[model samples]
Target: MPTKSLTHPVRTRASRGDIAVLYTVHLDTSHPTTGCDVSPAAVHEEYVVTRVTSVAADGAVTSVQDTRWSYDNSSRSLQDIPGVAKIFVIPQDRVDVEAALATAGAHTYPDTTVLRPYATMDEVCDAINPHRH
Candidate 1:
C-alpha cells in the first residue's frame, strides 16, 4: 500500500472566541492489507509533519507543508486541522474509522446521519494486516 499524508488549510474557531490559521493532513494507506496469522498492515516507518496551522477550509487539499516532526515506524500522518493546533494520528481504513467514530454518539449536522471520530493506528494496522502467521 502507498502511504501518503495530505495537508489541508484550516480555520479554527476556539471556545475562547479565537481563530487561528493552521495546516492539516490525513494519513492514508491506499491499499490496505488483510489476513489472519501475523500482524498485518502495521506501519513500519513513515515521514510525517509535526507543526501545522488551523485553516481547514472547503478548498482543495493537496500536498504536504508546514511540518514539525514525524513518528518513527509510524504509518499515521500528522494533520493540522482548523480550529485546533494539536497533533493527531488517524487511521484511513474504513473499518477502523467507523469503529472509532462510534464514540461521537450522534451527528446533528447531517440530521439522521451519525458522525464518528478517527481510529488509532494500532486498530487500523490490525484490521488491515490481520494475521498470517
Candidate 2:
C-alpha cells in the first residue's frame, strides 16, 4: 500500500527485474536445515528470492515470476529450457526484508545482493556501481 505524506502519496515498490529475498516459511520437503522436521507435515523456513516481473499502476508489487532452467534433450540437442512460475504475494507479509548489503544474505549469495528494491536514485546508482565513492 502507498503511504501518504503531507504533499502526496509515496510508494516504495519493486520494479521489473528486481530480485527480492524472502525469509520464507514453507513445508520442509527437503529439510535442508537442522531445525526442520523430516515429516510430510513439517514446517520449513529459509531465505529465498523471486524476480519481479511487473508492477501495478498503483505501484503495488502484488506478484512476481521466477524462472528455472532445465536441459532439453528430446526436441533440442543442447538447449536450456526455461520454466516460469508466477507467485502471489500478500499485502502485509513484511519480513523486515531490509535488503542493505545486508544482514540478510549478501555474503552467501553476492549475485542475489543486487536484488533489493532500489528505493532512491542514489541507492539505485550505488547498487548498480558499488565501487563509486
Candidate 3:
C-alpha cells in the first residue's frame, strides 16, 4: 500500500484595477518515508498561472498556464530531494509584470526568508547557497 504524504499550497495574486495576474504552486508526494523507513518516495509539483478578467466580478479567469515537475527517489537519501525553482514568462503587458511579481513575493511559502528575483535557475541556486561567500 502506498501512503499519501506531503502537500503544499502556494498562491499569489496581483491586480491593478480590473486586471489581475495570479500564480499558484501545488506539491504532492506519495510513498514517502522517514530515515528509518526502507521505502522510496515520489513527488510532483505543479505551477499554474491564471489571468483575471475582472477583479470586481471576483476575478474571472481569462487565461491560464500550467506546468509540472516530478521526480522519484528510491535511494531514500535526503540529498536526492528535487529542487523546485521555475521561471514563467507571463504574456502580460510590461507595466503589469512588476506588480505581478510583487504579489508573488508577498504570497510565497511562509518558511522562506528571502524572496529575491532571479533571471535564471543558476542565479537562484547561487543566492541560496550558504557557501557562496
On TM-score, the candidate that comes out on top is 2
The global C-alpha lDDT for each of the candidates, from Candidate 1 onward, is 0.28, 0.34, 0.30
Candidate 2 local lDDT, residue 39:
61
TM-score of every candidate relative to the true structure:
0.19, 0.31, 0.25
| lDDT-better candidate, 1 vs 2 | 2
**Tens digits of per-residue lDDT for model 2, 110-133:** 455343332233332233232211
RMSD of each: 16.7, 12.4, 15.7
Superposed by TM-score, candidate 1 places the C-alpha of residue 85 at a distance from the truth, in angstroms, of 1.2
Q: Which number leads on lDDT?
A: 2
List, in order, the clash count of every candidate structure. 30, 0, 0
Model 3 local distance difference test score: 0.30
For 1-133, candidate 1 gives per-residue lDDT tens digits of 5532223222222211111112223323564655642333443332122222222354212222221222242222223233222433332321233332222223123545432222333332333232111
Model 3 spans with C-alpha error above 4 angstroms: 1-41, 48-89, 111-133
lDDT of 3 at 7: 18
**Comparing 1 and 2 on TM-score, the stronger one:** 2
Better of 2 and 3 by lDDT: 2
